[model samples]
Target: MRVFATLLRRDLAMLLPGGRRGQSLLPFLFFLAIAMLYPFAVGPDADLLRRTGGGVIWVAALLASILPLDRLVAPDIEQGVFDQLAIRGIADEAAIAIRVLAHWLSFAPLLMVAALPASVLLNLDGSTLSIVVLGLLAGTPGLAAIGVTIAALTAGLRGGTALAGLLLVPLATPILIFGAGSLARPDDGGILLAAAISLVALAIAPFAGGAAIRAARDS
Candidate 1:
């Protein structure tokens, strides 16, 4: 338990602002850029923007989530961090689980906050903005899970970063679909489904990532 906490703190420091890479705000900035660009790209059709803004935010969040995929596990693998963890009796699955949690913390909350101003930029109504926030809360964990799993899988291959982005779009599309779909339905079942998917993704990521890391280590 103590080791997990220690690993989690290390990952947070590495991923958060002023850490190693120093790009902690990239996801937030990229998310807003997409939201801001949506208006100009589609012209000033207020109703169209309002009707679709939530979906646009969903897309932007999904894209932004993948931005750090390359950084998630690749560097650690290259640096033999996992090898060291193994010597300390820290299983890869536990390590990856911690990474998944840390990754979500690093970016999901920022995107949620960014959604506020993005809602204004897209002219989202108060109710719609609420739904958007709800959808993001439920969906980003799954996106983070998928991101970490893909990062582990593609960590060392040539052009893996681009490959990770490509892989993420498809894997995360279901979350996007259901998350954005929630805005259209008052039942809120879409958000529920999105949340369910997130749980499943979260459950699977650690084992999958650990296995991938082991495979990478062996080969």
Candidate 2:
């Protein structure tokens, strides 16, 4: 627990130079603005807005998540923190898990908060909003996990973000399917299935990411 807290603090410090200036908040704000603008760009009809809301919000969330992936592992690798941690007897698996958690802490909440205003703009109903929030709560961890692994794998590469996307988007298909599906059938078993898939992804991501990071470090 203490190790996690310490690492979390270290990550936060790295991410935010000054606590007063929230760094990742800008991306979230941009996500909100862009999501809100979609309806206006499409049309003002409430029915049209409602029909498109789920996809628009989900796409926006996915895009917003992409913005943070480069920051996940590059800085640590560049500054030798990753190597230091590797030398400190922390297992690569555990270290990657901690890093993913830290990434989630910084990025997922920003997406959730940003989603709220976009939800209103999209005309999400009570049930749909709850499902969206729940899906995000469940799914973003998976995104962060895969994202951390991809980030680690491409840590030193130029244009890593684009590479990461290519590697990650296919992996993220399940997440997008279930997450968006949850919105379509909030009352059905689909939401539960989405949540289940998320948990499974969460379980799978750490080990996958850890192995990738370990391999990257070795090579």
Best by lDDT: 1
Candidate 2: give its CA RMSD in angstroms: 2.3
Global Cα RMSD, each model: 0.7, 2.3
What TM-score, to 2 decimals, does candidate 1 have?
Answer: 0.99
lDDT of 1: 0.95
Q: Cα lDDT of all candidates, in order? A: 0.95, 0.75
Please report how far candidate 1 places residue 7 from its true position, in Å: 0.5
lDDT of 2 by residue, 167-192 (tens): 88887778888788876662646556
How do the residues 1-219 of candidate 1 rate in per-residue lDDT, one tens digit apiece?
788889989999999866786798999899999999999999999999999999999999999998898899999999999999988889999999999999999999999999999999999999999999999999999999999999999998999999999999999999999999999997899999999999999999999999999999899
Candidate 2 deviant stretches above 4 angstroms: 16-22, 186-188
How many clashes (backbone atoms < 3 Å, residues ≥3 apart in a chain or on different chains) does model 2 have? 0
Error (Å) of candidate 1 at residue 217 is 1.1
User: In TM-score terms, which candidate is top?
Assistant: 1
